[model samples]
Target: MSKEILTTKDLHLYYGDKEALKGINLNFDAKGITALIGPSGCGKSTYLRTLNRMNDLIPNVTITGTIKFKGQDLYAPSADTVQIRKEIGMVFQQPNPFPFSIYDNVIYGLRIAGEKDKEKLDAVVEKSLRQAAVWDEVKDHLHESALALSGGQQQRVCIARVLAVSPEIILLDEPTSALDPVSSSQIETTLLNLRHDYTIITVTHNLQQASRIADRTAFFMNGELVEVDQTKNIFMNPAEKQTEDYISGRFG
Candidate 1:
């Protein structure tokens, strides 16, 4: 059986008086991809942020219950939020590469962490770009400005940047929503190859994409987890009528 790397028990979150996430319980497997699917503002993204305590940055935000990483409480007062984020990196919907050279963008995190060894940084940059499936195309232009790259290439560079930090888990929030179909496919392919090394949780509004790439799918609606199961089962034989309705496009 795959190891359970992260888990939540009755997890809840609020922004001031508005509840964003109701009680959410989930167990995420190591080195696997789990997709969160729901309509906009249904709490899928909110829950994803909770995994790495990203919600803590918001003022007046309140969280309750337990989020555990390898059986350790993630919300503990003494828990290191910075460390959690380093281990669980996030890639957003739009590509947001820094206005730096391609090589510099990939090694940005390492530099912040005080790594000064050029040889080691070079090795990590190469490995990360290779893993993100964008090495060959940009290898000759490593010193070129990252902003000059196409949207898809920039997104892959962001992925490489995350990989260089050696994150154990990757959180993607509608990562392909802004890209063209071909670019989206490339990102999906890269993610598939990456599942052997990192746990990935992606929140997507695209139902078909979830079916195509997710090993397991969790359906959320109105701040609640409707159901979670194998991708095939969730798509072909959902246990809840609400899930079936949403999947069939009856309602979102």
Candidate 2:
């Protein structure tokens, strides 16, 4: 059995007076991809942010829950948010690469953390880009502006930036939604390759993408998890009628 790396219990989030997440309970295995699928405004993205305290950036955002990472309470008063984020890096929906050279973008986190070793940074940049499956495409253009790459390449570079920090977990929110089909497929392939080394959690609207890359699938509707199970089971034999309906296109 895969070891559990993250868990949430009775997680609730409120943006001012409106409840965004209602009593969520989920756990992620140490390695493999778990996809969160739901309609728009179903809180999948919001819940994803909560895992790394990304929601804390919003004003009037209130969270009440116990989120544990390797058995450590993530929201504990003494928990180091910076270290938590380093261990659990995030890639946003759009490819939001900084306007810097690809090499600089890959090593931005390390530089911020006071790493000034030229040789080490060079090695990390190459390794990270290789891991993100973009080294062959960008190895010769390391000093080129990241924005100069195609949309899909930029997303992969962003993924490399996260991997450069050697994070144990990667959170992706609609990572391929902005790309063309070919780019999206490339990103999916890269994610599949990364599953062996990192625990990946992603929020996506594409059911086909979830079936393609996710080992497990969680269906959310109206701020609650309708069902969660192995990808095959969720797609072929979901226990909840709501899940069945959504997957069958009976309702969204």
Q: Looking at model 2, report the run of 10 residues with the lowest lDDT sum.
A: 1-10
How far does residue 78 in candidate 2 sit from its true spot (Å)? 1.0
**Model 2, position 236: C-alpha lDDT score:** 99
CA deviation > 4 Å runs, candidate 1 = none
Q: Cα RMSDs of all predictions? A: 1.1, 1.0
- Model 1 scores worst on lDDT over the 10 consecutive residues at 1-10
Error of 1 at 119 (Å): 1.5
Q: Model 1, 131-245: lDDT tens per residue? A: 9999998999999999999999999999999999999999998999999999999999999999889999999999999999999999999999999999999999999999999
